[model samples]
Target: MTNRGRRIGRVGGGLPGIDRLFAALLARIDRGLAAGSIEVTLPGGGQRRLGGRAPGPGAVVDLRSWRALYRLATGGSAGWYEAWAAGEWASPDPVALFELFVANRHSLGDTARARFWSRLGRRLAHLARRNNPQKARENIAYHYDLGNDFYATWLDASMTYSSAMFEPGDTLEMGQAAKLAAILKRTNTQPAERILEIGCGWGSFAMLASGRGRRVHGVTLSAEQKRHVDAMALPGVDVTLTDYRALDGRYDAVVSIEMVEAVGREYWPAYLATIARVLKPGGRAAIQFIAFDPALFEAYARNVDFIQTYVFPGGLLIHEPEFRTIAERHGLRWEERYGFGPDYAETLRQWRERFDAADAEGRLPVDLDDGFRDLWRYYLMYCEGGFRGGGIDVVQVTLVKEG
Candidate 1:
């Protein structure tokens, strides 16, 4: 194994008789700093370490220098803080540093770069058992509960906040609408038929389907989303703040958009089972989800925490194949599969454009600078890259409950 790999494996594992690996790692970093091969010096003072454990004084960093240290500490085979002390890639604006990071995201290592992420996954799994509902609610609140007004400034009239479906040979708007229509078609909507939506965001699909004369029951983990959706509810729709597993009855069709990732791998089986349980035999349900390319699992696992910290908590981009396999395991058959990879790219572009234009208009909120803006920009552009590079895919999967 490579030295980086060995270090990661050792740290990830029990660390063989508790040999004080952190100390050894720290010593190695100290040595590297002394040898000058690792580089350690702070220039300007616009930066400080995130965790309290980072070094101090004379250890200050300029923006450019700090970024280089972050890259080295997080990317290389060793020295988390030592590398930051080097401060080689500093920039004047924090956003520039992030843009550089976003542009070169693929340069990060699989295990070492996302060391904080792996721990989070394990912690989530553990917490899921004890206070699943609270954790679920918090996760939802952290992401979707931000505020409807903020979302409204960019989303479609239907308030569909998930990835839009863009198809080849179609304009962005046409493709997105077509994607939604395609999912509706996949659900085989029948007038007056009962439908269930898991993790419903702002009730766009429910509203659309209800307009088609269907009775839609939408459940969401986010109370804010539920409240917003409920406020817009009409005669044929009901919006509830609830978990997918807690829904009481079966329906003619089920649909979930961009909600599965929060369910986590540990709960995938149960999640699928719940869907199957609520779906009537011969009924059709469509799921549109965020998925990473299967080959990129290692990178995803490592980097997922970055997203959790800055983008979506308890969020994941599962592989379409894995979802398919899980569906098969649950006796659910795939009826049709269409990918919305590029559509997401267009959607992000749209959102970025809207945000930039709005911000330029001096109408944007103050809390949107520095980290928040960086987070949103990274959220959009990296997602675009994920789709464009085929590192990620948004899939609309139509399925039927086996007889």
Candidate 2:
């Protein structure tokens, strides 16, 4: 029999009442492991044999604390009964632990989740101390400056690092190209017209626009991407390693793809105003982004920590209505909007494949491989589930400056 089944056998047969209790515990573990690996470690009260490795004393303690809190949150251990009976794992407070597990939505399989929680808790703790501008800059340089080549491995050719779902029966490349083309079409680009691209990653859109005989200027905070863009020097493309707030020129069209999220909640109005200032009156701008379900954010604050700390530092996602209101308040009128729910799932899957391919080819930093893989897997899968659950959505809004 399989290890899991063997474990299950220990508890399945009718036995003396005392023996039945032991069997029941094993049964729970079996059930928990049956669907997949049990990511969360068991509570301190349960058998330690099934518990995964604790990084150190702190992780174990934190988990134990969380377990207690979780049990209280979940109204007791009733939820874990089936798992205890299945012989996979056991927890004294199953309900609370399960509640916390699903709520975070970061854990993928068994091993990954445990490692993530441990590492994530550490990062959050680090953020609590020494989290001034210097540290923020250092963190950004470490993560975002991984080179355009590195990001290009997983990101779309345009390096639009937001949610993109594949339209029905569309490949990653096809859907992405369609999405980009859709953005260009919405902005009504014309030859010889000037366009500004905020947060340009590898300058793909700028290069493409230049190729089409339009003047395209792009801005980004990443010096790494700036170097790559400068090296390419495709005609009609101008790339700047600069901040959006520093931009001064007015353009016929402006596009900010997956960038606004970096504007923290307090800066939303100001950020929109800045965009309005640089956009010519009557000119259209495409603002494409991933937005959180506002209701979800209202429900919890810490739930967004993963995106803020790991993916985009100081980022805040808003609901479409809030975003539109902010833009309208800045004297911009929304012209068109589109949402791609499935496209992002397909995009993330492609990113995973490419990242894996690069890893297998020994192209990535050895020290970063495990973490990147774990991070990407969690990112991709959670996004897929989010899309599946409609917990999140992507939006492409075409806004024109009021005349």
Index of the highest-TM-score prediction: 1
Could you tell me every candidate's TM-score relative to the true structure?
0.73, 0.68
The local distance difference test score of model 2 is 0.59
TM-score of 2: 0.68
Candidates' lDDT values, in order? Answer: 0.62, 0.59
Q: Where's the lowest-lDDT run of ten residues in candidate 1?
A: 32-41
Error of 1 at 224 (Å): 1.8
State the lDDT of candidate 2 residue by residue for 305-353, as single tens digits. Answer: 4444455555556667788899999999987678876566567667777
In angstroms, the error of model 2 at 293 is 0.8
Model 1 lDDT per residue over 257-279, tens place: 88888887667777888888888
